[model samples]
Structure formats: C-alpha cells, structure tokens
Target: MAYVGTFSPNHSLLFSGTKHSLQYPASTRRGVVVVVRAESMTTEKLGIKIEKNPPEEKLTQLGVRKWPKWGCPPSNFPWTYEAKETCYLLEGKVKVTPSGSDESVEIGAGDLVVFPKGMSCTWDVSVGVDKHYNFE
Candidate 1:
C-alpha cells in the first residue's frame, strides 16, 4: 500500500503506513494531518512524464518562465533527447509516441512535461505549440 500525506510544520508528529498511525512528541499534544492514497502513473516504460495542469507554485519554483521558449506549427517529427529536458507548455496540443512503443502521451497547455535523456520519440503536433523548456 502506498500513501501520500501533507502536514503543517507546526505539527511534530510522525506518520507510518497506509493505515496511518501518528506518534507525537512528549511536548506536543495534537495536530491535524491529511493523508491520501497515491495512484501511480507508470513512466518507467517510456521514461516520459506528463504532469497535467501543474500548480503555479510548482511552475514558479522550476523557473519555467526563465527557460528558453520554443514553438512549432502542426507537424510530425522524430526526435532524440541528448539530455534530459523539462518543459512547461503555454499553449497548443501535442502527442508524443516513443520509438518502438504503441503507447503515446498527449500533452497541452498548462502541462509540465519531462523527457529523459537518450529517449527517442516522435512528436505529433496537432495544434501549434508554445512552451518554455530547459535541458539538464
């Protein structure tokens, strides 16, 4: 079982397991904790990750606006990443199909996407794309 949880720093408590158990420090009495079960999105197969409608705080933290911008009209092309690439889409839609794999991922505006280094994939742009991208 997998669990995801968030708590305020004011709480001095530890949580363990899917069925969460809380242990508080001797000095602290009680606090509020929120826990949710995690649903896994499998990215290990293609090494491509698409985060849909990521929070503005996450975008700001990644400095997405500071990265270089790239745009392309509706088209299809093959690309291989020499380095890991992270990008935030501002507009348009795209479908990326990895080489030798039938599965494809669709991404569009308000999405944060990551392409692992050495990945070979096809970019099928149905709508023009405008994005800020960074290579690491």
Candidate 2:
C-alpha cells in the first residue's frame, strides 16, 4: 500500500491517507515553502551537506551577512569537530575526506557546508581558504 501523509512544520505527521486521497490545502497562512521527500530520495550520502554554486540572491535570502572570517594558506591537515559546524565559503578550494575513507568532497567559494559533530576528517586546502563559520 502507498503511504501518504501530511507533515507539520516540525515534521510530525498530522494526518494519513487511507480511504481518502490526500491533498494539500489550497490556502496556507504560513508563507514557507514545504518540500517533502520519501526516504533515500537521493543516491549520495557522505555525511556532508552542500549547497553548491548557489545564486547570490538565494545566499542573501539565507541571511548571509558578514560573519567572523577565517583564512588559511594552502595546507593539508587532519581535524575533528567537537560540535556541528556550518560554513559559507567566501573564497578558495578544499577537499575533505572522512576518517578511514578514500571518498572526499570538493568545496569552493559560494559553497555552504555542514560538518557533523564528532566527525573526523582531513582538510585539504588547495587554493588557500577563507570562510565564515558557525558552530552548534
């Protein structure tokens, strides 16, 4: 049987479609756009979230304000995060590979990345690095 349901803003299931077909309400007081995807909708899963080559307008909408900046010269180093980290790259290129894994992610300017807490990774800053980061 096909599972159908509506989720609230907090992602809790509000209702399910069984005998009746499911449909979204024509009007909603909330202006936010909601996207619902079934499990394993995408193939890639590397524990890193990236918004690649995002447009300036979308970045602005994400509240990309001037943040405390950090920079480093071209280098390679192993690192581990004590807490979750989110960063918006301002400039440079980087490759991050998870511990005991050969697979790596290429990151550059205009890329938004989230590194999970307690993740052990190696950072390869190829073209130097400059970015704004926040930890949670």
lDDT of 2 by residue, 12-126 (tens): 4443442322254535423534334333211223798887655666556766655577889999999999999878888999999999898998888877788899999999999
| Global CA lDDT computed for model 2 | 0.72
Q: Show the colliding residue pairs in model 1.
A: none
Collision count of model 2: 0
Model 1 residue runs over 4 Å out of place are 1-45
Error of 2 at 24 (Å): 36
> Candidate 2: lDDT of 125?
95
TM-score of each: 0.67, 0.62
Give all candidates' CA lDDT scores: 0.78, 0.72
Least accurate stretch of 10 residues (summed lDDT) in model 1? 36-45
